[model samples]
Target chain A: MPREDVEDLELELLLEALYRHYGYDFREYARASIKRRMWRRMMEEGLATLSGLQERVLHDPACMERLLLDLSINVTSMFRDPTFYRAVRDKIVPLLRTYPFIRIWNPGCSTGEETYSLAILLREEGLESRARIYATDINAAVLQQAKEGIFPLDRMQEFTHNYLRYGGRCSFSDYYKVYGDRARFDPSLLEHAVFAQHNLVSDASFNEFNLIVCRNVMIYFDRALQDKVHDLFYRSLVRSGVLALGHKESIRFTSHADAYEELDRQEKLYRRVL
Target chain B: MVVGGSWGGLDALGQLVALLEEGCSLALAVALHRAADSPEGAMVSYLQSRCPLPVAEAEDKDAIQPGRVYLAPADYHLLVEPGRFALSIDAPVHHSRPSIDVLFETAADAYEEASGAVILTGANDDGCRGIRHMKRRGGVTMVQDPCTAVRREMPDAAIATGAVDKVLPLDQIAAVLNGLGRA
Candidate 1:
């Protein structure tokens, strides 16, 4: 038998074992992505085989933690697409202005780039004072990084460029203090932000929000999982609240498409109409 | 040719595969970064339905052909010889077995000047080095414009290497491949 076929079966067995042994539900995620991540790590760590890696994961808590981090793709940058931020500033912020108090969800908020970016944007728009921002991810390593709010100083140039392109009204540097070789964002920006662990694949909705931005995160999920997260987003949104997706993700074919109208098609912004 | 990607890569691969014109003279194999649980055959089936070329799940030691798209089945590293596909129990590269780099490197050694490599939308820097190797060995290099990519990291990394010969939008990539087919 081909080793890949056997590895595929082993991966299925590993997923099952993980759920039975650890209660982390990843059975529904897109399989190929998962396999690639695991296989990539296996090569990096010098494991002899998939089963060998599985044995290590089953026995070692630290190993499993590392595996979880590897499985979660947390590549993100501040103000990733400036135009998307501008759309939020113009279209979503106005509606947020009407609500006396608001909650916003940033699901799969890797390394807190989008979380902090949203917080900074809301603070500038005078909405953070009355808003509660919940940023959740399955990766604890990235969450720790997010909480630090310390980014490489080398990235400042690019961040500044993206900020300007996204329609920043103030100097992008105004929001953060540059320390030695690192830029530490103002802690004040995070005053209303809550960083926590929430798995979109397994966690239940804990709070409803006036706006939910789950950008660039859902493409890793299979159609069923995407639909599940869409249901979670639909359940978590207040009627007439807004939803923002990454440039590629859409609710068009999902169950939630009817629940939201495309507010800005180019930016993938939507508002719950039903 | 070997292909690899994750996140926003599915549509990108579909377009790339569909662009392979009928009766073209090159054996193409793709290692799509996909989940082990998702149906691999469906993507091949989907591409087969659209393109005039044959598309299917790659089998071990399958003959490489022009005008064909062979997907690296989930969880395996797909390697290539001059005219055949090989599977490896060898470790994954950059955390992926059917790694784009592994395929590109091998194909670079084999196909050299005749090779054509494309890196599309993905969240990680998986294809950068692969595209570099392809170009180093005189293979044609094409990258999706990161600005328009759904997940720009892969193509962005390739462009950052200064190895990409052409960077086009996703919609325009098929035409380029079609043109190459005609040429």
Candidate 2:
């Protein structure tokens, strides 16, 4: 047919190869964004077509790892949306305080920026000892960086601004020390946190949680995939537990729309009502 | 329908939407260059106050509906699927988030021949390539006549490509769009 249609066919074959060979199912991700990422990686690898990239991905483990990084969409920042964290402090923290212990899941926690931010919030609220954060991602490469808790020092200024805007209680610099081009976060911030590689697509619920902060992750998933993950979240959360999503995300189109009550609509926080 | 503007966009957008009238029978996805941290939902509220069509800032997975208006939320690239809206934080194209190119390209791919693109007063050329792609895909392409635009550069850039199907004055855009929507 058309050349565009041919490219789409190539894209489908490559994604299928990626899923079957790698067990990393990106088949359900949003088409436009995922396709763009595929093209990006293809060009980066000096390959001209999706099929050509697929061959290298299957043959070279190193190629797969690099492609994984792009597909994971690791773009994030400390308190990326400050208002969401503000709501977590004002509205969600009190609910966490009701419980003697707290389990927070940070799914798709790429590079641990927000995970550390969450830990800092917990410590500030004096909930550090009582709370345990399960920071997980589909890519282990990012999880290792998350565990290290170091970020580009250049980004510190923006994160510091976000921290202040969120009404941070202490000097933002108190949390980290500069090391070369990086700023290494205090180890205590990660003491109660565990990092792991968890696949949201095929993995089952491992534990019930008091709060699940999965921001900016599902925007890359399609409708069916979003519904599947929402079901997992619904099952993974305790009754009245909080679910925070990316600022512009909503539960309205998902299967669990009626199951959760809006805790903060603008911030996309929902409380499991039933 | 995909609509794009940059500099001097607000007045042109306001007048265009006001003239589109109620029950226009087409979904309008608009992208204008605005800073990411501008007052949240302020533009949507402003547009809603003047436009006959229902206006709101886009949210993920929002289904595109006829006669409704959707604005690209700040700092995010707005994309389209067959019948819904998708948002992305992917690095900005043409130095703009909610880049006119992103919206127009995806909308053209999804809607194909049924899509229409209108480029209006912009200082930059973000929407030019998109309108060209839209024309190649059998979509209708229109631009505000450069002479009538506040910043003639954007429209002039689009017209230079010879891809625009029609180049109308800013005031006359609504009538052509309404007619196209009906057809």
Q: Which model scores highest in TM-score?
A: 2
Candidate 1 stretches greater than 4 Å from native = B1-183
The DockQ value obtained for model 2 is 0.55
Worst 10 residues of 1 chain A by lDDT: A28-37
Computed on alpha carbons, the lDDT of every model, listed in order, comes to 0.78, 0.89
Q: What shift in Å separates residue B15 of candidate 2 from its native position after superposition? A: 2.3
In candidate 2, the residue pairs with backbone N, CA or C atoms under 3 Å apart (3 or more residues apart, or in different chains) clash, namely none
Place model 1 in a CAPRI quality band.
incorrect
Where model 2 places Cα greater than 4 Å from the true spot, the runs are none
lDDT of 1 by residue, B116-160 (tens): 787878888887777887887788888888887788878878889
lDDT of 2 at A223: 89
Worst 10 residues of 2 chain B by lDDT: B35-44
Tens digit of per-residue lDDT, candidate 2, span A1-274: 9877888899899889988898889888988878878888999999988889989999999999999988765566798878889999999999999999999999999889889999999999999999999999999899998888888899999899889888999999999999999999999899999998899999999999999999988999998999999999999999999999998888997888999999888898999999
Give the per-residue lDDT of model 2 (tens digit) for B85-175: 8888877788898899889988998898999999999999999879988998899999998888899889999999899999998668899
